[model samples]
Target: MILAVLLIAVQVAAQDPRLDRLDPDTRAQVTAVVDSARLAGLPAEPLIQRALEGATKGAPGPRIVTAVRRLSVDLGTARAALGDGASVPELEAGVAALRAGATPQVLANLHSVRRPPLTMALSVLADLVASGVPADSAAVAVLALAPKARDADLVEFRRAVERDIALGAPPAAATSIRVNAGADVLNAAGPPPPGPALPRRP
Candidate 1:
């Protein structure tokens, strides 16, 4: 019994070292939130990381708590969109995509393509939207290129679009040009190559 108790204590302490920095009440609140997320089978690590990020940035206790709670909700939404089998990284990317106006249907469709490591594609989609591209246009553009483009290709595409946008091109036009360019490359190569490595998540 004593050994079991010590093991439990160690487990709890290992959950979040940053929790030690929080005041007692705030720590308790955050711990409760983390426990609830774990119980729900959601990835609680992101929430813990978010809280730690906030704390490191010198945010107040309430704000840190709020950020963690919000991330939990986002993770839940992402899981619902991506289905039960979604990895934590997939869910994280999905949340960012959702926040940038990608509908759950869009997310589902993206996942249906059977591509792994969609983190960069989803992030590029979000970045496009955040850069003033219409969400629908961004989705269309991303979906068209993602199935064929490698991670390096996606990075180049994003950079091209950004450059075009900086040069006074409309977001839609810039995205279209880059996506079409990718298509051109694919057509020139003939037959798709093997899939690229999984995306690296932030």
Candidate 2:
């Protein structure tokens, strides 16, 4: 009876199609994470579940591997906090929320805030940084004011760009300001100087 049960368990494990779906690199990373978790006296099953949940939720496979790697570093802490009963989807949700700026205290409150489209938010934030706003400042400003921003709020954000430029802030700083504001605001504020025009050929 014991031999038959062991054979069935092995067959079930081998039949999981998702294990075969992972690319070679991702499989290696996942295996490494699972091994580390086992060594840490944590069950490997939860980590595997988290990876599968992330995959089902449309997170890239590389990101799933990265998340598991991070989890492996503190497997004991994770297990203590999350409990052995936590499902893979719950772990993925918690990690994603944390990365999105939810603190441990505020993490439970996340259900109240309507999440903005991540792609658009990232694009806008990146543009702000590229425009000359300091990355730290730009990130803060956008997060604080994004919900309240009107067309005119964008105008004010632009004014900050002009102020930064006039103050002789570096090009990178200026880019950050533009990111917090908007490109149209910068255009209206007037363009920054052109790089030295082609030297006249005598």
Relative to the unseen true structure, what is the C-alpha lDDT of residue 171 in candidate 2, on a scale of 0 to 100? 49
The global C-alpha lDDT for each of the candidates, from Candidate 1 onward, is 0.80, 0.52
Task: Give per-residue CA lDDT, model 1, range 67-104, as digits (tens).
Answer: 88888888888787677778887888889999999988
Alpha carbon lDDT at 183, candidate 2? 41
TM-score top scorer? 1
**lDDT for model 1:** 0.80
**Best-performing candidate as measured by lDDT:** 1
Clashes of each: 0, 12
- lDDT (Cα, tens digit) per residue for candidate 2, span 72-142: 55445323444454344444444443444334333222222213222233334445555555555545555
Model 1 is weakest, by summed lDDT over 10 consecutive residues, at: 193-202
- Between which residue pairs do clashes occur in model 1? none
Clashes of 1: 0
Off by over 4 Å in 2: 1-17, 78-202
